[model samples]
Target: MTHASCEPARITEPDLIAIRDDLASREPIFHRPEWGSTRADFERMIAEGFWETGASGRRYSRAFVLDELERRYASPPLDDDWESCDFHCQRLAADIYLLTYSLRQGARETRRSTIWQRAGSDWKIVFHQGTIVQDA
Candidate 1:
């Protein structure tokens, strides 16, 4: 029998704080609807909005993220969950911002966050995470 090893993905305190700041607010920090539809939409969002997932202990390189995205595209199409998403954003610095949101699909609900940094005239994501909310 072979045991597969898995590493827990972790994000830094500052990044966590940035994400939390967005979540703490009742109002959305920013709004962009075009980046929330299909895999291609999200890929465009990732490419144009984030540099990378600046998260530690996870395989979140640009190639990795792209590959993962491609894999998702290979699967059956998902519902347009973003249409019902509750989103929020917070600025961590002059060009650094955190976006957080919750989405519901079928019977499952998930909370997600991403950190973005502005480079030149574009914004790039440096970190991302999604957590499923379970019923009590």
Candidate 2:
């Protein structure tokens, strides 16, 4: 009898790009012009075990992110114009993906990345990090 090893499924670059682009579209949900709309959007997508690193050098848990998001939503509005860099995505596993990009709002630019995992029928962000870039 011969034993065979099973390899994971393969993903093409184009497919990976599509997946990444789809996820990126969700970003504006957090920063929409209308606070009420943003809050409503945030509530639907957050998943368990979500963690993120803030540009301020602080680590936040899912609960903390939610709380902070709510507080920010309640604060006075601001004039925010943001520019984003090209997105890069990689498939870490059959169901895991990594995405990286940069966004500049005003004079501050931050490089950000996120790891997304398949959660049942939908995708959810498992980890995220944002680092301030000294030079644009």
Candidate 3:
């Protein structure tokens, strides 16, 4: 049997735009991890208080966010397929974004946003927040 060599999928501008729109609109159905990871645990974390926004409008804890994403959201078999872009930056090359979505039991959409910073060759998350855009 001959084996076929696999190629990586390329990300494009439209893809980025779609991702931005999805997050901005809170369309949770399409939000999944880029690495094909699961988000069940992240969803749970959000359900809890790990990803909550306080009255001060600031996130409660970055440690909770990092831990949840790295350990749970980015795990195998689940596959988080979310996407994002640096729309606020003057140049796309200097801006970065991370986005995700979660739905309520009734299938309502909630979008998550995380601003990223480039460190060497990897993108590190500098900020994370999410909002419920619509019910349905």
In TM-score terms, which candidate is top? 2
Instruction: Please tell me which predicted candidate would have the highest lDDT against the true structure.
Output: 2
Report lDDT (Cα) of residue 19, candidate 3. 41
lDDT of 3 by residue, 1-136 (tens): 3344462232335646654553344323224444224444344323232344522366666455546556654435364444432322211355455554343434444445444444454334444555665555
For each candidate, what TM-score against the reference? 0.50, 0.74, 0.37
In the range 12-131, model 1's lDDT, one tens digit per residue, is 366456554534342111223333435565564464434342223243656676666667657654544332354555677887776766655556666667777665764555667666
Q: List the residue pairs that clash in candidate 1.
A: 29-89, 49-123, 49-124, 49-125, 50-124, 50-125, 51-124, 51-125, 54-126
Tell me the tens digit of each residue's lDDT in model 2 across 70-136.
7886877576688776677788898998877788887888888888777777667788888888644
For each candidate, what is the lDDT? 0.53, 0.72, 0.43
Candidate 1 TM-score to native: 0.50
lDDT of 1: 0.53
How badly does each model clash, as a count of residue pairs?
9, 0, 11
- Between candidates 1 and 2, the one scoring higher on lDDT is 2
